[model samples]
Target: MSSKREEELLECPICWDSFNIVENVPYILWCGHTLCKTCILSLRWAEVKLPTLPVQLPLFVSCPWCQLLSFRLVWKGNLRFPRKNFFLLWLVESANGNRVRYCPSSSCDHNFVLPSNRSTVSRNGSSSSSEYLHETPRSSPRDRQRTNHSLLGGWRILTLLMNLTAKFPVVIIFMLIVLYVIPASAAILVLYLLITFLFALPSILVLYFSYPILDWLVREIIA
Candidate 1:
């Protein structure tokens, strides 16, 4: 929808009431809260430590209305202005000098100013400032996929390394022992070795990969 029509059709999920949205600015989440592209981009810029990958972006975001964590809303089409597209799309700073995410609805003109120290806004009916909530839960589909891919990739790499190390001594001994065997039986010995190596390779690779991951899990539990 065009920015003008989008503004008209958009309703606050929390309130279920129509609200005006500003075009060519921040994108509103499903929960009716507005967030600047910079805000979402900034989250992608930060690194979070994980067990598998040494570090990764903490892409999880919070809902503006219900104060729940949510996946980011991607802005596309004419709503995304061209001049500002490079900066916003790549997490570049806005020329206007405001680094924080602002309310995209030019009509509503609500700005999401995240204060230092607090991570989320409260939806509770309490009027007290103390009642305002922060620290929304962490949940992002991209983050989940990234974590899973990292784990699988790391295991594969580690297994490759382990197999190279573990089989070296055995391979050397097998070669040395074969050299001392009678020449008539040498062909039979070579065939036996080849069959043994082929049969054991898959199992060895599996054990190599599984052990370290298992060890890491155990250590995490103990810690």
Candidate 2:
């Protein structure tokens, strides 16, 4: 059985829920505190927004314990996801008696499972207390080899493309010159430029309009 302090350490400060490997994974904040992933997602919506500032600006969330503000970059009106605290996750799993073992080989990315009935033996032949190992079935060596080959082939193709681009920069310049020289390609280029400008115009306008308001807000916040 885990101690009271250990149980408290495994619980999220915000939700008061115990951390688990599945839904309640522990995510560490910039302020050196950990919270559940669900609570972090909730914080995104709870962040205070400056009505006068542009909505595209990064959002800030105050830590529940320290009140220290942490800025999260916005992507499509959503805050950037925080990193998971794997160490805390391991501790939680160990406390729950679910011991996860990884493959000893550096080449093998997948985990191999040990039988729950067997005791895990150490290098010195000492037996440790057996725990339930929950892991997916390991891939065969042939499958691993094929996967590695496929990844290597993909990297080779990418390197070939990069080498071609580096060796034949003149070809790219010639293609660009031809595009402008030809009326059809020139019209296509113009249309592409127009589309890009149309897409970027709204953001530009928002920034232009919100500059003054943002300046005032910064001064007020700093003061």
Candidate 3:
């Protein structure tokens, strides 16, 4: 059997859960093999493999079991959705390290880790450099209402501007070209229609889906 397969079959030395996939259990990966997190934790960092943590580390950590450098591990967490109990595959490092990366999928259970460069660049090259960003999550009713209004206002203004900018120019160009190249004009009109349809169809579908959900939320909040 492959070493990875063998590692998967063997029970975690700590939690005694099967490697790789456990029923809502956390496992650490060492040399492409998985072991229980608890087992990995309890072992004196010598018997278990440790993956490279995402953030900067003072030194590199090695797996105790396989004597190889580790990179990824999975573990369960409290945050959950409809059916699946999610797990995090995080990098392991010393006491002072960076947080693990959250999953990128709209609905994801696994939080994976990524690598970091030795030296990072900043505009000022100052240690005091900071980044400020705002992200909205599942929000309150009032917040949602305000955001919806803002988005709608922006969309309306943008559409109006787009129509004004495009309609006259398109019409004049079409008319001008049509005076000479009848077949070319026909082809251009058809292409324009297809392009508009391609873009507008997806938007219509989005509105169709979003409207019902937004309606329900609004009603529930209002009630």
Candidate 4:
């Protein structure tokens, strides 16, 4: 049997629902009180006034337990809420028999992995069931998987570029030649040809006309 303190830790004060990995993910406020994501969304949604126009305006979310007000902005018809409490989430997962493992590499897309086996006591001496309300969850596995794959692909591309730049000094020079040097050289050559043609044309016309005018004047003077 779980103690009263353990039960309190596992459940949200507002909805009285046990924190889970899905819908009731734990979120901590600036005032140090923890609430489930559903309750937080509910509070924010309650304060939303009917939009006079299509644009949804910002609203203040007040904590039910402390009445502490938090200013939140409406982004694309969704309220931007506080960050999830990962420590509390780990505790919840741990209490529910889910073992959390972190990636060894710092550059990993997913920070931690949760695998469920059997119920166990967490470091904080809390044990709970995995059942949770099917309220609107903040995140889904498919979303997370998609995000991880996108991030991993981006990282792979970045890593490949970095490796190419580092391993072969010629690659950097080749890129510079392709992206900057070649274009600049072509522009400079074109400008040089244009300037030479402009200057030479004016000088040749001036000389051609001057010779005839000078000879005519001299012939007139001689005659």
Candidate 5:
């Protein structure tokens, strides 16, 4: 990609500002639109510490922009955007010598630089991200694949179910009217919808509405 296009990509669609990895890092929503981390964090006021997932990746934070409803993981005990655009992170870090600032007043056109962070540096001075959630470093292909699977395994089936059932309240009632109440002669239509809904609805609802509730139960049994 050209530098201009990359700069455009690094710009957050929500705030229309250049991304600062520290605050305005790009967070991809479930809908796949990337927004500034600051924007996503400001949308939710509820603060809770989620338990770490064993053999699990990040926890799901509700996508405020998705409006339709989707989840992603909460990286911090406080409000930290979990899904990161590391490529963007590298781009910003390599910005040579730029400072991060917050525009305190809405009227302020100039940025007021925030106090420099006391970034954790080892005794030997290697920067470590043990505190805040940061992107993983490069790894072997097998390790990468495993990590990828861990991240997507929980979401893939869940996403499919959500998409399938999203129009259900209208579709289900329509199906009931046609499948049972309509003329019995419409056998073909009834057979198809019946079989499809019957086999799919149970799993769909379980994944969409009830998966979180059951997650603990399954974990307990596994333990």
Candidate 6:
């Protein structure tokens, strides 16, 4: 894991504060973005999109940065989500040595270790020995290969469009100029429909699939 610089550690994406590792413990989303727990809690009402199992209360979290949607896991009622970035947590501890305190309410200050698995309830409503993130570095190469292929396909299509734009820049420029040359209302409507089909539709599908996509990912890791 790459060591995060101190300046990067201080900036919380949500609240924009110098978030600490203890109470404001960082939680990772399937998209691999980390946010302060407090900020995540405040997003309890975030809209959940795609749920494969159709559980009674399927949770979802939308990445504020990338706008990518992911399955928001709830071990109990909180957004347990992905494993806490333990590597990052330890880095913060090592850098802030002696100054790090796990609990804010306790008078006796000490760093806090992650909770035991027995203490946390599994999604299947049974006791589990494995913590949500315990020993999770076991992704299979085949699954990864398939995902990479899909991404590569998307990239190739995008590159083709970019090449076309570059080769026929005048044609594209003329089309844009033609659109604006039309009546204002007609131009706006044309532009809106074009953007919706070209950008919005694909983005929505990607976000919708993100939940199941990552679930398969976690299973591959666990396996």
- TM of each candidate vs. truth: 0.22, 0.36, 0.20, 0.35, 0.32, 0.35
lDDT of 2 by residue, 127-169 (tens): 9877676545455667645644654455456446644644475
Higher-lDDT candidate of 3 and 4: 4
| Model 5, residue pairs in steric clash | 59-73, 60-72, 60-73, 61-72, 61-73
In the order shown, the candidates' Cα RMSDs to the true structure are 30.3, 24.5, 34.2, 19.7, 27.5, 31.7
Among all candidates shown, the one with the greatest lDDT: 2
Score residue 4 of candidate 5 by CA lDDT: 55
- Model 3, runs deviating above 4 Å: 1-10, 14-30, 43-60, 71-223
The model with the greater lDDT, 2 or 5, is: 2
**74 Cα displacement, candidate 2 (Å):** 8.0
Report the lDDT tens digits of candidate 1 across residue range 20-67.
Answer: 224324454433344554443444423445888755334345544455
Candidate 1 yields a Cα-based lDDT of 0.46
Worst 10 residues of 6 by lDDT: 101-110
Sort the candidates on lDDT, descending order: 2, 4, 6, 5, 1, 3
lDDT of each: 0.46, 0.66, 0.45, 0.64, 0.57, 0.59
TM-score of 4: 0.35
- In model 4, the runs with Cα more than 4 Å from the true position are 44-57, 73-79, 98-223
Please give, for residues 38-104, the per-residue lDDT of candidate 5 as tens digits: 7776654333446763332234444555453335445445444446755556556643222222212
* Decoy 5 TM-score against native: 0.32
Worst 10 residues of 3 by lDDT: 90-99
Judge candidate 5 at residue 37 and give its lDDT. 69
By TM-score, how accurate is candidate 3? Answer: 0.20
Best by TM-score: 2
